[model samples]
Structures are given as C-alpha cells and as structure tokens.
Target: MVPPTTGPTHHLGKSEIEYYAMLAKTEVQHYSGTNIELGTACGKYFRVCTLSITDPGDSDIIRSLESA
Candidate 1:
C-alpha cells in the first residue's frame, strides 16, 4: 500500500500569498475588496512577476534545484 505524504496540505494564508506576491516582479492584485484592503497597508511594494533569465543554461540549473 502507498504511505502517507510527509505533511498535511497547508493552505497559503492571505499574508503568505501577499508575501510571495511582493517577491514577484509584477503587480499582484485580487478582485476581492478584502484582499485589496489588507494588501494596501503594505504599500506599492506588493506586486505580481518574474525575472527574465533567457540564458538556456538556467534551465539545467532549475532542473537541478527541483531534483534536489
């Protein structure tokens, strides 16, 4: 039989979601007014995005990290 996974499913809270959003390179917004209100306090620092790593070598590096 298959064994259980290491940990329970942990849902990301609004704060955690915002945290990652801020780390992203673009603006992150939610349609919900509640999210807007909460995220607003953080100022414009919070946003949605990604860095352009066009170097093909990066793919190999990413794969290595995922395997690790």
Candidate 2:
C-alpha cells in the first residue's frame, strides 16, 4: 500500500501519515519529483508530496531505488 502526503503538512510537522509510518519503522521513499508528477505516476488526478511503498511486489524497485 502507498499512502500520500502533502508537502506543506509534512514540512509543518503535522503529517499524520508520516508520523504513523515512522512509528511503524517503515521505509519512506522520497520521490524526486513534484507533487503533480508523483500523483501522475500513481495514476491519481491530484498531487502527492510523499508516499510509502509497503509492498514492492516481484520487481526490483527497492534495489533500483537504492542504486539511484
């Protein structure tokens, strides 16, 4: 599962999604793209500041990200 976050909310230290993810010790992947780009990649018609990839499936997404 991937959960979205807003830029302002995160910067203001009021992002509940980020807080919960930290508590759960989950890895947070920061997309080096704008909110609109992130949203587009996720197939959403909105903005996305941040996102957590809970499951990477059978792909080498994690490895590729690390490499990048």
Q: Tens-digit lDDT track for model 2 on 10-43?
A: 5655456566678887655556667887788778
The true-versus-predicted C-alpha distance at residue 31 of model 1, in Å, is 0.9
Q: Flag regions of model 2 displaced more than 4 Å.
A: 1-6, 13-18
Q: Write candidate 1's Cα lDDT for 1-68 as tens digits.
A: 11111112133444454565568643333332233333353244543121222353634634533464
In order of appearance, the predictions have TM-scores of: 0.26, 0.56
Against the reference, the lDDT scores of all candidates come to 0.34, 0.65
- The TM-score between candidate 2 and the true structure equals 0.56
- Model 1 segments beyond 4 Å from truth? 1-12, 33-68
RMSD of 2: 3.3
